[model samples]
Target: MDVIVETRYGKVLGREEEGVRTFLGIPYARAPQGERRFLPPEPVEPWTGVLDARAYGPICPQVANPLNPVDGFAQSEDCLRLCVYAPAEGTGHPVMVWIHGGAYVFGSGQSPWYDGRAFARDGVVLVTLNYRLGPLGFLHLAHLGGEAYASSGNAGILDQIAALTFVRDTIEAFGGDPNRVTVAGESAGAWSVGTLLVTEAARGLFQQAILQSGIPFQYRTPESAEWFTAQLLDALGLSPSSWRRLFDVPAADLVSAAARIPARDGLNLRPVLDGVTLTQSFWDALRDGHAAHVPTLAGSNREELMLWVARESEWRALSDEERIARVDRMWGPLTDRARDYYVDGRTGDELLTWLVRFASMRTFTYPTIRAAEIQSEYAPVYLYRFDYRPSRLGAAHALEIPFVFGTYAHPSARALIGERPTHADVSDAMHAAWVAFVRSGSPQAPNLPEWPTYDPKRRSTLIFDEAPRVEDDPDSAERELWSDMTSLSM
Candidate 1:
């Protein structure tokens, strides 16, 4: 079965699968190639004939990795596309728009693990989109000014706003309600949602947002971002006189140049604090009740830092004194608290995993707490802590994606989580909670524990463990430790 819908960019034929109709590689904007590399996305021209959107689009150009086996895939610059999945017999179902995460440097909406079929099964329309990344998506060239470069260092986020506007203007033709939309994401995507929540440009586009493993703390200052952009040009052998040379350089060269650029001391290449598109930090806006009306769902996993700590063989070579010293430096004054909870008296590999987990919790816990505090004033906020450990990796980063999407048979799913049913029920509960939230503002579901909205009084949280339960203020000890340290609210 097929459904042909007329979009502003002309007609598109969507293919029907078993239970859902899917449209893939639908262009929301014109390709940002050549002269338009660092510029804002342009409106896609209307096509006279029907566009066959049966296949997934190409992923954005990214740096390839040798040690990390998964990064070895075909990538390109012509990747500003979107994929949509909705019920075949749809009328007015709620919608969920997903944004993938890879530290704002890599990741695409085209990954098989992000398949929205399960979301459609859960009675929601799911849309995943791809936008520019790396230098093309986030560089702040000092010369470009005006609305053409108004978004500048934050082109990736502007691309998202454009995609949401497209959805707001056109999704009704596909049998989904525009007003009942929920935007959700993990890691950098979660941070992007945080950014969207505070922006005046994103007003009324989404009713609810889910931030998984991230909050407002993950941002770079504008001055720093501009400095990094200048360094990139210098490394490419282009004089300041030839700043415009970046526009003509081959896309492959730009992507390759990204690989050679060293990590900014300790900073990641991400959405920067350009004063135009993003005037104030997300924390500033959330603190001043800017996002008071927006409902939010925020949380971090139990073993969130295992992957970052164990990505390479760096930990193996460190001596005991050096290792423990490194841990102390990472945790600083919080080392005592982390040692008390995670390490206790553990040593060697056990201690390493414990410290990694503590570090991740330290980084994310405060931000999530702050976000909850600010948003709870106007709307219900759902808070959670994923503590389900699947084998040695524990409950590492991105472990919850497949579970929430209910794609147990995906190849990457099997790779990330081994064949185990120990945590399957937890996934079912979480996915159900997500679907219920989209259906209405409340996340209450039948047969599940009564999930409470976050409040300063109870500091209530949904504890997702072997036996899922609602706990009153699970992170009180840690929250108290960071009270004085919290300079910003969200």
Candidate 2:
């Protein structure tokens, strides 16, 4: 059935399946092309007639990775669009906005893994959105563009804010409650959720947050951003003085140039501390209780780094001595303590797997713990750790996404989680908890036990495995070793 709803911009024709009404490719903001490129997102221009929002919009421009491919999606500069899924009968359902993760480079709202039909079936309105990516989104070019591009570095984040604003003003027409919105995501998207908590521009945009497999602190300073921008210009054959020519450079050329810049070059083109759009450090803001006082659910997967390690052939073949040197270089003075905790008696593949697990703790798990600790000071924070090991790969990064979205049966999911029978029980428990959090501030659901809130003393964390259980200070020994380390590395 075709359903037509009148939005602020104009009438949008959506399609209905079962009891869910889906409206895809709705322009939340104006097309970010030509003059609007790299600038703060502008409000969508009012339309004349009903807009056919049946198909997914073009995804943000990025270099495609064949290894981790996003199948059957168009890409273009006019990619600042969002999708909405709501129950056909509900008038005031809670809204859950999802920001897809792709290391701030790839991924989009159109990813099949992020389908919102399941959420609609559960009586929640699900909204998925796309923001600028890569150099076009996060490049720090304010030093060259000056006043016209002060918020250039954070253009992607600003796009999210704009989408939320549109939802606030217009989602009520789509059977959603503007005042009852929860923002959620995994990895880079989760990082955005954390960043939004402390962002003044996103002050009243959401009522709660859910961060999965993400770090709350990962922003480059202005000095570092300037250095990265200089290198990027060099890669594009533009000198510092000719930096303004970047606006004229083709988007494809810019993306290619960005992809060529090595990771070791210190050219991190992620979010930046621009001293404007992002005024303060996210960590400092959270610690000082400057973040939103809304309830939060933050967690990461066990063996989170194994996914990356599984892709690296050279790292898998490293000698014991080489592994020790790599660990020392990465962990600094904590190498001995970490080795004793993780790789003391292991050898070969077992040793490498343990090393990857330790790296996961340092990079993803510990940072999430710190975030929960800081957030608990101001509001109720629930912490969790996903331990449901798949067939080949363990509970690695992004492994919990399908379970949370109730899309475990998806073909894409089968690649990550083998062809074995899907874990329907775990999916029900996890998805219910997510829906519970969106509707009410707590993640407590009937499918799971009474989950307690997190605190510094107990550090109660829910471990999601075949038999899920709550454990207080799980992995306490390893966590204690990093207690003195004030900051977490990305």
Candidate 3:
């Protein structure tokens, strides 16, 4: 039940459960406390003595999200920790490093939803880690703080690279193949994976990528990041000249102030275009073959935005004037043209459905397709659409987490997938495809149909539902809704 592994940083103790060996709370980078706050991650200092790796480490300081809470775990500024689940009896097993998503604000590697036991049982070494979030990890400060804060906005992203670097150097001791590491995440985590695909620092750290409901292009430009920073500083009652006070403010207070950072045109405080860490957009990088070496499997749930809008009564009860005004704000001069496509004569649930679809396409689906199309030109890319409606609520964002990770029985997952026996069956099929994709370059599984690589022409996409099938350009009509959108709504 007990095991010891000597890593370059130090020796650590771990435990075995069932047939999998788990090492918890392994620090990949040094604690970013005190002066290190808002800076890129530094290499973990080598430790003496056998460190006990028995519990999940502290997660980044964050406000709790009702849907994805990290309450059980302790939190701190020194939260760059990782958990490893590896097969007890294998060497050179495929490795999976999972980055969690909570809109770049909340969520942790320690979430029960990310339990890696299933991956371990299936002969994969699964690793999950915590990184800085919200203002602590992504507050754009270079514009205000000069060279010392040049990489401040991308600190979270650099934390991921640091974790990947740790895996490459250390996972071999835990029976994992460093060369076969696959980076995977959902939502904001997916955005990180997509961003990693193009990041120069992450060029060779990963071999494959799995992005669920995010494509690389969702970052704040320097102007937007600076605006958000100004908002944050203002919330703290400080001016541009008083930026130094940010370092002295408590993390909890920063989180509180960040909550007040008003969203503009749907922008949130997330990874920024820090000119240094990332030079080009995901689209440009893909077109230039930055991710050509990595095979990719990416997708979005059918109703990604519904997770945000579906539960709100205001979305359904909006007066026509209010809802139409919302559309006008987004469409501007093209408002009538947009209404013709999404409005025309629809109302009530029909109109709500169209609105949700339009939101999904503009934000998630269209960007996903664009990433795939551009990346497919240089490498093998597989696309998917998760269409399983766990209930009439529709397969909203992050609903596929239960199926993808075989965690349906988790209370939160159960809430999303329901108690249907078929949910497990679908999970089995989808999980197998994900495992297959990680093992080989293709996602061919026993239950899945022959899935062809995505090209602009065929655009073959594997649809995961009660009945898994392959479709060429599924929902092409809906996809065309954003055909002329030089700019996306999100």
Candidate 4:
């Protein structure tokens, strides 16, 4: 029997399996197509009949390789949907709204890695959503298109705000508590959560946040956004005057063109720091008390760059000269300082391994700590360093997703964890911490170690290894390397 629920917008049908009531592919906003392609999302109108929401919805337009699109959904521009996983036995459970990460290029709520059954079974209403990506979702048309397109650059983040609005207004019907919502994500999704912290429009939509391996680095400023916009327009062969042609061109063209525009680190076409949508100081937003009411759990993995850099043959084959030059660029005058600290100078896998460590920290880890230090002043914040190595990749980016969701047995996760044996104990502890945070404001899981709130002086961070434990200021020597530099972006 189909379970029917009436939301404020309309009645929808969902499926129930294994003690979880899952309502998939529910539209949060009208199809962002035609004139609305680059505009902010518009609310979905109320439908008269019961809507079929058993199947997952189409994901935003991107290059979805038919063989293995991680989102595991069809592609289209009319994609502004979310999936809700509510416990079969609950009426007022705390909500965890998960945002799937793909460097703002791909992935959707239907990502197999983001299965929410664990959260549902543990008495939390889990919501995962899809947002715009690449040129269609993030291209900056405001400067060329004028005031009408002022927000065109930030349409993706706006899509997220719209999804949060949907949750706030309608989550009650699905057995969730609107006032007790936690907005959580990993990687770009985690960056999006951090972005939402400063997004004035997104204020009060969520009460707590969980950022797992959220690379805290470069965000697109207006100047940078315009440069990216220029590149995309050129890729499409559209003159400045003919920018309007974007509406008529096929999304596939946009996707293909976006792939050609190389972005070594983040400024490809993700969320822009449009003064209208995002504030200037992204990290300071937490310190300034924009989200004083919200507590936070923020952390990065042990070797964040390894997962991405390991597969790139070009990166693997860098000469010592080229390697030193790249490090110089990343650290500037601090290059010698970094060289002295790194100490490992042999080439091949050894140098690359050490380089990965330096890049991950220089690019991601330091910024994360600085952000946490700022946020810790106003509200309670818990820090963590995920040290569980899944395969030789060594606890890299997105490795914690399956563990956080407790989807340990998923095929993709199996492939990622590989034949070297999986760790259910790590997954269980990590997943429980997430659940505990969602239910209460703290991540003090019953089975896990005592997790104290973070303070700048001590910098207590829970290490999620085979033996999960809390330590004060892990690797302080490496962290202090970037101390003099007030601002850092990879």
Residue range 219-276, candidate 2, lDDT tens digits? 8888888887888988888998998788798888888888887664223677888988
TM-score of each: 0.93, 0.96, 0.96, 0.95
Supply every candidate's count of residue pairs whose N, Cα or C atoms clash at under 3 angstroms: 0, 0, 0, 0
Candidate 3 per-residue C-alpha lDDT over 334-357 given as tens digits, one digit per residue, 9 for 90 to 100: 344567887779877787777777
Worst 10 residues of 1 by lDDT: 65-74
lDDT of 4 by residue, 197-268 (tens): 877999899999988777445677778878777787888888888988989989988888887887644557
How far residue 385's Cα lies from its native spot in candidate 3, in Å, is 0.4
lDDT string for model 1 (268-335, tens) is 47877777778887777777776776778888887787755666578878865567677666544344
lDDT of 1 at 453: 91
lDDT scores of the candidates, listed in order: 0.78, 0.86, 0.86, 0.83
Which pairs of residues collide in candidate 1? none
Q: What's the CA RMSD for each of the models? A: 2.5, 1.9, 1.8, 2.2
Candidate 3 residue-wise lDDT at 161: 99
Residue 143 lDDT in model 3? 84
lDDT comparison, 1 vs 3, better candidate? 3
